[model samples]
Target: MLESLTMVRHGESAGNAALAEAITAGAEESGPGLRDSDIPLSDLGRAQAGAVGKWLARQWDSVDAVLCSPYVRALETAEIALRAGRAPAVRVDERLRDREQGLLGGLTELGVQRRYPAEAAARELMGRFYYRPPGGEAWTDVALRLRTLLPELEGHVLVFAHDLVIVMVRYILDDLDESTILKIESNQLANASISRWERDHSGLRLLKYNDVGHLQ
Candidate 1:
């Protein structure tokens, strides 16, 4: 059985910053104009990752394993954190990648409605949890992959990944339903925030959720 699990969302990326700007400007494309997997961190994101590493150094004597998403932003975060904390090397896991947005990859909500009305309508009908974007994986699909990964992890493990992956982890571990998970997702996770669980008699129990105290 796993003793403990600590998950961290990657620090803010250039893509993150771009998306926010795009939303404000009402742009059709909300990403950094690069493939999602290739986007890098912003300056603040690097600082945040460093803070997470410092927090890790203060919290635990050592972590048994470190895993990270293969995406550049996540990889950079993991690298920065590991260097700061003197933690073990991270093993990149493709399974931990950000949710593939597919055809909807860079489109803002307005863009989605304007460009792909049918897809937007379909997504509304299916709901966010089950709505697989044309060529993208749904939230449930994310959970399925995490389910496979969770069982194999043992001891204290740290993961550096995306916000969606963090949410899916909580959904699977807590046995949460669609409504509860969606509610949780509504409060977007902060950049470089921490979520953790520790094993007890009953099994793993949540010790923290979306904790960003370290960043402050």
Candidate 2:
């Protein structure tokens, strides 16, 4: 059985940079209009991934299995942090992919308000957990898929995924509700952060949350 699982969010990506810039500028939209799955890592992201890889290389004796989202940023992070597949072979899991942003994929709140007003208003009213964009997914959708994925894996599993993926996984393990989970997401963690949890006789117990000491 899987004793423990360590989840790592992909390093900062070009999308991340653009989003940050958009927020800084309070723009109408964000990101480079590229497919969300195609965005690559930024230079800082590469350095962060290298640092995480070295840290993990020293800390973990072995990883029994590795899973990753197929998104380019997540793939790059897994390659770097695992030393280019020198560790456990990475298995791409569609369930581990980032939450589908849909019409909101590359837009900020302002952008959504300007270009997708009804969608934006609906999101605010429906809440983040169940707000499914026209062609995207809800947070609950991501959680349901991961819940299915967990039952089939075992041993020490390492995963390279995304921010929403990380938070949803935590919410699943902790058995949190919409209110509490919303609170959890508000205090966002950094890129490339790691979190660990162990399963025992009782249940899942968190070993770490948003750990990034190696980047220091």
Candidate 3:
């Protein structure tokens, strides 16, 4: 059985900033132009990663294993945090990637409504948890992938990944329902936020959720 699991969301990326800007300005596309996996972290994102690393150093003596998503932003965050904390080498895991947006990849909510009304309507009917955009994976799909990965991990493990992945981890480990998980997701996880779980007599219990005290 796994002893402890700590998952960290990647620091904010340029794509994250662009998406917010597009939504705020009512633009159609976020306009990062690059593919999702290639987007890098922003300056503040790097600083956040460094802060998380320092906090990690102060919290625990060592993590048995470090795993990270292959996405550039996640990779960069893992690298920075590891260096700062003098942690072990990281292993890249594609299963830890962010939820694929597919046809909705670059579009803001307004863009989706204006450009793909049918899809927007379909999504509304299906709800966020079950809605799978054309060619994209739904929230359940992410949980499926994580299920395959969970049994493989052992001892104290640190994972650096995306927001959806972090939330899905909680959903699966906690046996949460769709509405509960959606409620948790609604509160946007902070850049470089940390969540931890520890194994006890019954099972793994959440110790922290989206803890960003170190960033402040």
For model 1, residues 94-210, the per-residue Cα lDDT tens digits are 899999999999998989999999999999999999999989999999999998999999888999999999999999999999999999999999999999999999999999999
Kindly list the per-residue Cα lDDT of model 3 for residues 88-200, writing each as its tens digit: 77999999999999999999989999999999999999999999999999999999999999999998999999999999999999999999999999998889999999999
2 or 3, which is superior by TM-score? 3
lDDT of 3: 0.92
| Pairs that clash in candidate 3 | none
What TM-score would candidate 1 get against the native?
Answer: 0.97
How much does candidate 3 score in TM-score? 0.97
Candidate numbers, best lDDT first, in rank order: 3, 1, 2
| RMSD value for candidate 3 | 1.0
Which stretches of candidate 1 lie above 4 Å from their native place? none
lDDT of model 1 at residue 25? 96
TM-score to native of every candidate shown: 0.97, 0.95, 0.97
Total clashing residue pairs per candidate? 0, 2, 0
